[model samples]
Every structure is written in structure tokens, then in C-alpha cells.
Target chain A: MEIVVCIKQVPDVPTVRMDRERMTIIREGVESVINPLDYIALEAALELRQKAGGHVCIITMGPVQSEVALREALAVGADQAILLTDPDFAGADTLATSHVLARAIQKIEPFPDLILCGMQTTDSDTGHVGPQIAEELGLPQVCGVNEIHREGKFLVVKRLSDGFVDTVKVTLPTLLTVTKGLCPVRDLPLGALEAAFSTKDVLEWNMTDLDLKKEEVGFAGSATQVRRLRTPPPRGSGDIIEGPPDVLVGHLLRRLEALSILDEEDEKK
Target chain B: MRLEPTMKQAVIRRSVRKFSERRLIAAAVEMDKTEQFPWDIAEEMAGLQYFGLEIPATYGGAGLDSVSTAIVIEEISKANAAMGLCISVHNGVAASPVYLFGNAEQHRRFLNPLAQGKKIGTFCLTEPNAGSDASALETNAIRDGGDYILNGNKVFVTNGGISGINLIFAKTRADGKDLGFSVFIVESEREGLEKGPIEDLMGMRGNPVCPLSLRDCRIPLENRLGDEGGGLKIALSTLGGGRLGIAAQALGIAQASLDASIKYAKERRQFGKAICDFGAIQDLLAEVGTRIEASRLLTHRACDLREKGKKYTMESAMAKVYASEIAVEATRVGVQIHGGYGYTKAYPIERFYRDAKVCEIYEGTSEIQRVVIARELLKG
Candidate 1:
């Protein structure tokens, strides 16, 4: 049960500011933290390793400063931390980011038996990287996993999809994109923090180390470009209807139909 | 010359803040109202080496540096000052002296459990007659063959109710002559050791501060900490370090109050605008914010000095006095910013106000801190 957990360091959401002029996020001077959901994934991986007896290795692809996130994960009980940092890895979209992650995973000796990631990152919120990494590695993946159980080389997981609870059992060497309830992230112990921050043990991988070309890793490999960035329009105030529960339900259905969020047939059902 | 917190210290602050916010904040209120120690939370904290913040890892301690240790206490105090007081006193005054003075056998026997958090530790010095004048302690440890017969009553023993190990300061009497003060590692379960009822307090009510009495308590000669007459030296040195922990605690309380004030000012509307929009409210916020920031710098400077093994007695005294004073002031301003709402328990500002006052009073009063600073300045 060698597990690989992918993590990203993003600007703390509350402190984030948009660079209106440059049409991008203002990252300088802002505090960075591991994505909250990624913490859940890491927590899940640790639990699995605890139950199955395997090493949990955490990896992240970002600038040198992103080592903070890796150190944090190490402090939280990750067995190993690999920092994937390179100037050539800048401006990577979900596609290129997953490619680099997949390549790094392939380079791991004996190859990881399981891969894990958060369902989405707070900064990008694309929910694409996990599935893309699975596709690139040709591994089966389950997204939005909320519960996990291990049984004899198979993992049974539960997730919510289209308002339906789906319990899927997958064989070994699979990937999972965990959601909030996968496990609770315990606070990192203070004793481990000092060594984690000071230790030079974090393995660093660059373009040359991963056998990756510059054009296929960074901005050049990105398939999507932001033509323009704008804040979403403020929502208008909604009508406050005073009615009984039954009447409120009827009114809600009618409004949904009017907004084309639901069709007349679905409303009838 | 660098003023900014190092990356490690910054992460420590963030990590402790998250743990405090998510866990300690809610427990603080409940503990305050109930006046009961949360042993469960204590156990949780022990697992993270909160009790052994400066103890070496070889002895089951966290082994953090002085600055990082202070940061931890500060963040914990921010969420719950009572619990903060527990850790600060346990680590700074009690466990620290044992590590600094105790020999190998003592470290293996006493420091191990204290660092492991398996046994809560306390520094029992203040008695009925010995408040500011520590030498006035009437507690006597007389030489009686291989054992020392100790008779004294220690009052206002912080963490007394839950402490398993108590560092008792007593006057050593041999051949009917006083041999100055000496410290003894007195286990709470010893015969003649009795714990008094918990005191009803204004702030930090969750801490079980009580009186401890040793009625003809007998202990082996090995129980004496350091030399037979080295208690005062250990006490002075330990308290100097202890003041830094108190300063950090004060800074935490002050920071918490400022945060509450800022949030409340922005939300509470008066005269058709949020109170934050008013110039008077802004002045209060700005003043408290600046003071809290200054308090942090002063506290961190003392921590830095201590960490680097430099002379920080005066610096720690200054930090303790300034930070504690500003904590009281910040909480006052916090309550004022909240107006009438701050007067009630509806907001935590009132709790912060109560918790901040004790920071000035404990470890050493603001006046005592000033005295220490003056004594250092006048040294030839």
C-alpha cells in the first residue's frame, strides 16, 4: 500500500486578492497554505497506510517556496516528501501539472500502489488535475470519495454523484480524489514541526530529473489560456416568499423552471 | 537584525492557531463556565508535545527553541488563556528548571514523565508570607537522617489540582541554622501532601489554582533539586525564562481581543453606519492594534535573546511588563469598541478582558518586572 498524495500550496483564500490590471491573482506577500481539501486527502492516505502498513509519500509541484507545504505534510506524518519545483514548471495548467505528477509517480521505485488527491483545489477549483493524472497514468480513479474501506487488495469507497450515493469497489493500484468527509485532518504535532522545517530531506525533482522537456511541462504545455479574467456579477436580491413548506416547494420549483435550471417534466415528477 | 518571524516560526504560529481555533476556543468557554479541567483536551495536547515544548526529544519532549516555544504559548493563550497558563507554567517554570539543573538520574526519573505529559508539573513557591519576597517563605526542609522532613503550605499553586509532580521551594535547615532556599521534587501522592480546594477566580477560571500543604512530608536526600542551597539561583533563573512565557501569553490575549474588536466594529452598526465607520471607534481599534503589535515585538525579542543563550533577564522583564500592560489595555479597548455588547458574555471580548489581567499579576506582577529591569540597569 505505498501511497502517493498530491498536494498544492495556494494563497490563503481570505487573504487572496485579484490583480485586476494583470487579470491574475496577486500571490506576492500573501500567506500560502496547503489546500484544505488536499489535507483531507493526505489524512486519508495516512489512515490507509496505518491500516495497511505502507509508506505514504507526499508530492507537490510549485516554486521553491512550495516546499513549505511539503514540509507541513511531512510534519503531519507523511513518511516522505518530494518537492517538484522548477522555473520550467511555472504557469502549468491542470493538464501539464498532471503530466509532471504522473511522470514523477512513474519514477518512484516499485511504483506507488495508490494515488490520492483532493477533489479540487481552493485556488483553481477546476477539479481536473486528479482525473487527468489518472488518465495519464492509465489507472482507474474514483472522484469525490467520502468514505473508504480496505479489504484484501480491494478498496470499497462511497461518493455522492448526481444526488445518488455510489459505492464502488476498485482493485489495487488505483487513484482517488477525496472529498471533505474522507477523514479528519489532525493538527500537526508541534514536536515534528521544527525538524520538518529544518531537515534537508525533502527530495527535489526538476525537469531534467523527471526527464521532462520545458515546452511540454510549463506554459507551453498548457492547452487553455485565459483570454480575460473578470469577477462574476453580483447576484441580485431574490424575492422573499412567506408561505408554508408545501407552498414554498411549489414556488421553488416554478422559479427553477423559469430560470431553466429544471425542465417542466422534472418539476412534474 | 531580522524582525520578521522565520519560516519555521511562522508555520508554528499558523499550526497552533488552527488547532486552537478549531479545538480550544469552544472548550475554553465550557471550561470557564464549568470550572473543570478538560483532561481529554489535555491528553490531546500532550500527544502533540505541548507539555514538553522545550524538552529535548531524547527525553520525550518537543525540544523547540525558545522563540518557537513562546509562539506556541501565545497561540494557545489566544484561544484559551487558562489552558495557555497550564502549558506555560508547566513548561517554563517547572519542567525547564528540572532540565536545567537536575542531573542524569533526576532527568530520567522526573523530567521524562513531565515532558511526556503523563505527569503534569507545577512550581510551588508562593506561600502566605512569600509573595513578592520569595526569601520570606516559611516552608522548612529539615535534615532528618537520610530523609528531609518538610513542613509548609504553598498557596495559589497553578495546576495544583492536576499536577503529579510539584517543584517545592523550601528553606533548608541543618544544625538549627538556615542553609538558604533549596528546591525539592515532591510528588503529589507523597504522605502528608494534601491538595486544597480549587479557588474561584475572575479570569483563567478553568485553571485549577489551589493551595498545597506538606505536613511533615518526608523525602529522600536525592529529591532535592540542584544543590542544598541553590534554590534561589534556580528560582531567579527559571522565573526570568518564565516571564517570557507570560509575555507570550499576554500577547496572545491582546491579539485575540484586537481581533474580536475589529470583527465587532465592522459588524455592529450604530447611527446608521457600522461602528467601524465612526472615527472614535477607529481610534480605539488603531491604538489597540498598534499596542498589540508592539507587544509581539517585545515578547519575540526576549524570546530571541533567550534562544540565542544571550542575557535576556532585563529584556524578558521589559517584555513581560509591557506585554501584560498592553494586554489589559487591549482588552479594555476591545470591550469599549463593542460598547454595551462587550460588557456581556455574548462576545468573547469580556473573557479576554478578564484573562488579560492575570497576565500582569502572575509569574511576576508588572511592578516586579519593572523592579527587575531597574535592578539590571543599575548594575555596575
Candidate 2:
């Protein structure tokens, strides 16, 4: 089985500063890193490849700088990396991005038996790319997957839904959007990085390479447009009531009653 | 062109940072308290090629440049100084000499295992009589048929108890006259080689700094590194690079000290505001931060010269002395910033304080570094 992992390079900061006027992230002075959840997806792909005896290929849609993330993935034991970079591929929304990725995956040699992706990206947080790509490829997909394994010819997936875990079995040629709880991220070996840069080839694909048309990718193909963006307001602090236990209880009850959080009839009963 | 770490080097730094944050930093206090060698962490680092930073990839090493090697040491030392010391001694002195001076067969035997982390290595140069004065070492190696019998006690051997390959230097007599020195690769499993108990130290307790006694230990003729009486040259060259490693380690300790102080200052309140608001605390922070950046630049300059195959003896010596002294001072200020809590075992600042002092004394003392710098200047 051949596994393909879709990765994204996100800003390496807790809170990203956004350019509200431009409706985009303020990339200046911000360092880029592999998306946190994508590391879990890559780890999952690597584990499965280790057991099944196949190649783990990582694909990412970003600029030339995003190749660092792909090389990092290679350092952690990915067999190959394909970078989708082109001026036309910029400003793509989730639907356009998934369409481009699906075309790129089809261009990979030997094809991919399994496709893996993070549930959502930290920058966008749309959580639509994985399912959209699955739809684009005409393949089965599992979203928000916390655990996954191979059972015979099918894949077993476990995901939490409404506070209960749902386990489902799906056939091959499937896409999985993994969560952070899947597995621990492995360290990148120094020798592996040296070997990757010196020996491994990180193939680059453009619009022509993937046979993508101008109307199907990039800003021209994007269906959603952001008119404005802003950071959320800071949360307000809670009120603390302090006194003796009886007095505190009385104050809490009176406050709750004043706020109408408690029913007077129920309190009397 | 840039003195800062390259993109690839930055990746390496981040990887090490992640590993150290999760593994070494959490276990540092317990390891210090128990005085136990962190074999597991060593194994993990070896798997990550931390032990083989400067070694060539063909020889089961990472094949990174000298600057990258220093970065690895600095990052690791920031988390745990004792582990840093072990790696410095192993890579800088022990494995490096064998790779530089050893024959093909010797490299295949000794350097391979050491680089692979299957076996730990250490340099045995300091004797009871020879601390800074290496020529005064009393250990003697006698030439026997097909073997050389080594009889000496080496003191303060880093990674001594756990090491498998020991690069030992001893005085040799040739033609009825005492020649300079000879280096030998003595395996720890050899007969008559006894490892002393771990030293009870004020700092860097996690390192197995111990004594080794070699009584009639017979090493094969091929085990000798370089030529007869060529040990001094080998020792000098190995230590020239080793000083940079120590400097980087010191820089790491200093940076950690400043980090701890800054963290504590922000959270610790006094006089109705955080202590960080005070002018005195801010002064300490600024001075330490500047010193650390200067030390890093000096250390990296030495590394750059070494990588370019230029003479960096004086540069490395200057860096070592400056960085080590700053480390001691910075940790002292770190402890002062924490006030009473820094003195207790509850905080890591106390551990940093204890670990900082030894950086000035090891590899080469600050006095010795100053002397080396002066000697190089005089020669020019």
C-alpha cells in the first residue's frame, strides 16, 4: 500500500496577527512550521507504511518556503515529498485547494492507496479540505479520526461523536483527517535531515504539471471571498463572591435569583 | 554569509529543542538528586544522531559542520548541563581524535561504535597530578611484545563509568629516555581496568565523573592513535576544538539562567508590582542577555574558523574563558533573582546555579584559557 499525507505550513505562533484590511495573515516576521495536527497525520501514515511495507509520500500546497516543512517530514521518515507551488495557486480557498491537491495526487506515480490529512488547519480552521478532497477524488473518507488501523483489506477508524466514540470500517482508497490524539510526533533525526537534503528529491508541481486550468484553481477558482477579518475580543473575568459559608450561599442564591437563573417556584419547593 | 544558524541548522535546533524539552528538562532534577547516568536519554539522542554531529555520514555519523555541532551542544546544555558535558567529552575529545588520527582499521573498530552510540567514549587525560598541567601526568605505558601495558589512574573522567571506549594518554619511555606521550584506545572490558565510583560533586552530578585505574592493561599495538610521542600534538588539537564545545555549553547555561530569571521576575511580585518592573532586575536581565549573545557570537566565530580549516586556537580560548565566566555570573544572578526560592530544590534555578560553576573549570580552566590566548598572541 502506498500512503499519501497532505500537510500545510502554518505560522509558528500561539496567536497570529491578521491583516484585517487585506483579509489575510500578517506573514511578515512570522516563522512558518508544519501544522500541528498534520504531524499526527504524517505519523499515522509513517506507522502504517512501516507495518505494510510501502512508501509514505507527503504533499503540501504552499510557496517555496513550505518545502522546509516537507523536508522536515522527510527527515521524520517520509519516502518522498511533492510541493505544489505556483503563482496561480495562491489565494485558494478550501474548495479550490482540495481540487488542486486531488489533481496533484493523481499525478503521483504508482498512485496513492491511502490519503491522510489533518482535520483542520490552524490558520483557516475550515475543516472542509479533507472531505472536499475525498469528494473530488471520488474516494471514501473518515473525518475527525482519533484512532486508525488496518484490519485485513479494510481500514478501521474511531472518532468521537456526541461524546461517544464511533468505530467504522472502510475499504481501501480512502482519505482520513486525523486529530492530534492519534499518536505522538516522532523526532527528526539529524542524519535523516542530512540525507534528505543531500539525496532525496522534493518534486515541485505547477499548474501545467498537474494539468490544472486557470478556472479550477487559485484565486480565480475560489468560491468564497473574505470581506473582512478581525481578532475576537478578550474574554471578561468572572465575579468571585467571598464570605462565610452561610453568607456566601445566601449571596450566591440571591445573585442567581436576581439573574433569573433559578426558578422561584422550584426554590420554594 | 550570515553568522546565525542556517535554515537547515534551525530545523536541527528546533528538533533538539523539542527532544530536550520533553525528555531532558523534565528529568534533570531527579537525575541530579539520584546522581544516576541517563542511559536512556543517551540512547535516544544517539538515535537522533546527536552523538555524531561532526562525524561524517560514511562513518555512521551526522556529518554536520563544527557550527552545527556547537548548536547541538548548546541546545542540549540548555536543558541539562551534565548530559551536555558527557556529549562534549565524547565527541570533542574521544571520538574526534580517533577519527582524525586513527587508521582505517581503528576507525572501523572504535569510531564506528562510538558514533553509533552503541558504545560511549571518553578522554582520559587528567591525572591526580595533572590538572591543567597535562605534561605532568604520571601514567606510564610500557612496550611489550605485540602489546603495550598501560598502568595509570586517570581522574575526573567524564562519562567514565558508562563509557566503553577510553582514549587514554600515558608517558612512554623510548631508547632508555622518557619521550613525550602516547595515546591508546583501551576498551573498558579489558582485564585490569577498574572504574571508580562516581564523584560526589557540587554540580553536574548527573555526569559519571569518576576515576579509572588501568593496572597492567594490555592494549594491542594497532590501538595506538597517531605515532609514538605524537600524543601531545593530538591532545592539543583535540582540545583546541573541545574548548569551543565547552564554550557553547557555557553559553547554553548562561542563556538558561537568563531565561529562568526572566520567568521568575515576571511572576514574582514585590512592592505591589512584579519584580521585573524594578530597575535592578531589568539591569540584570539586560546584562545577561547581552553577554549571552556576545558569547554565542564568539563561540560561533570559533566554529566558523574551525570549519574553514583556519587557526582558531586563540579565538576558541577567548570564547571559552568569556562564555564560562559569564555562565557562572549569570547563574549567580539567576539565583539572586529568585531570592530564597532559587536556593531550594523546588526550583531549577538552584540546579542551574550548581551546574554553571563547573563549566569554567572543565575542558580547560579559565586561567588556562587566558594563558592559551596569551601564548597564541605572543607567537603572532
Please name the candidate that would achieve the greatest TM-score relative to the true structure.
2
State how far residue A92 of model 2 sits from its true place (Å): 2.5
User: What lDDT, from 0 to 1, does candidate 2 have?
Assistant: 0.90
Cα deviation at B3, candidate 1, in Å, is 1.9
Clashing pairs in 1: none
TM-score of each candidate's B chain against the true B chain: 0.99, 0.98
Query: Per-candidate DockQ versus the true complex?
Result: 0.74, 0.68
Q: Give the TM-score of candidate 2.
A: 0.95
TM-score of chain A of each: 0.87, 0.96
What's each prediction's TM-score?
Answer: 0.94, 0.95
The residue ranges of model 1 lying beyond 4 angstroms of the native Cα positions read A14-16, A151-153, A236-269
Worst 10 residues of 1 chain A by lDDT: A15-24
| Candidate 1, residue A150: how far the Cα is off, in Å | 3.9
Against the reference, the lDDT scores of all candidates come to: 0.91, 0.90
